[model samples]
Target: MRVLGIDPGSRHTGYGVVDGHGNRLVHVTSGTIAVPGSLPFPERLGVIFARIDALIRQTAPHECAVEDVFMSRNAKSALILGQARGAAVVAGVQAGLPVFEYSALQIKQAVAGFGKADKEQVKQMVRTLLRVTGRLSSHAADALAVAVCHLHSRTSPLCRQVGEQR
Candidate 1:
């Protein structure tokens, strides 16, 4: 199975694609979609939707995993994040890709063996698991980690139940 994982942000959304079979995962591509801060919020959203839609068409992923909105002390920041996530979901739905949402904690636990793992630890774990070298931004690595989490967790009863319905 091929999965596209998304870490949504108003300014920079990160995405990672991976091929997985059973419990094993192989990296395909990983990067960020950077929206200029100078652009209007609506324009930025349009850019995000268009880029992600094109990515979905090009990669043709079988599934998509997105990090759910994490609560933030700043309500404004949370709202903007939610908007980005909405655009992402719209793109996936338009592409007819099955989208699944996972929490940051879930992704950390699955990738780093602990929910409370720090960002650096999660990055290291993602690098080791995907067997890649060099540094990836916390955003990019987090997106990849979400993909890894889905690969390992997709066979759970939750996913099976959803798949069976389709």
Candidate 2:
């Protein structure tokens, strides 16, 4: 199964593509869709939506995994984050891919074995799991982690049971 994972941000949304078979996973691509901060917020959202749409068309993923919005100290910031996530989710749905949302804690626990793992730890774990040697941006690493988390969740018996129930 080919999965596309998204870590959405107003300024820099990250994405990763991975192919999974049973317990094995292979990374296909990972990158950040950088939107200039100078642009208007609405325009930035449009750019994010367009880029994500393009990515879905290019990668043709069977499913998509997206990190859910987390509460922030700044209410405005949190709202923008949620908007960005909405745009990404809409792109995935429009592409006709099964979209799954996972919390940051879930992603961290799946990739790093701890919910409170730091960015460095998550990056290291992603690198180790994907057998990647090159440098990866934090956003891209997080996106890859989301992909890995989805694959892990899909293979879990409990998750499968829950999914079937739904």
Cα lDDT listed for each candidate:
0.88, 0.89
Cα deviation of 9 in candidate 1 (Å)? 0.3
Best by lDDT: 2
Put down candidate 1 lDDT per residue, 18-111, tens digits, no spaces: 8997667888888899999999999999999999999998898999999888899999999999999989988998898888888888899999
Count clashes in each candidate, considering only residues at least 3 apart in sequence or on different chains: 0, 0
**Runs with alpha carbons beyond 4 Å of true place in candidate 1:** 158-166
How close is every model to the real structure, measured as TM-score?
Answer: 0.92, 0.93
For residue 23, what is the lDDT in candidate 2?
83
Candidate 2: the clashing residue pairs are: none
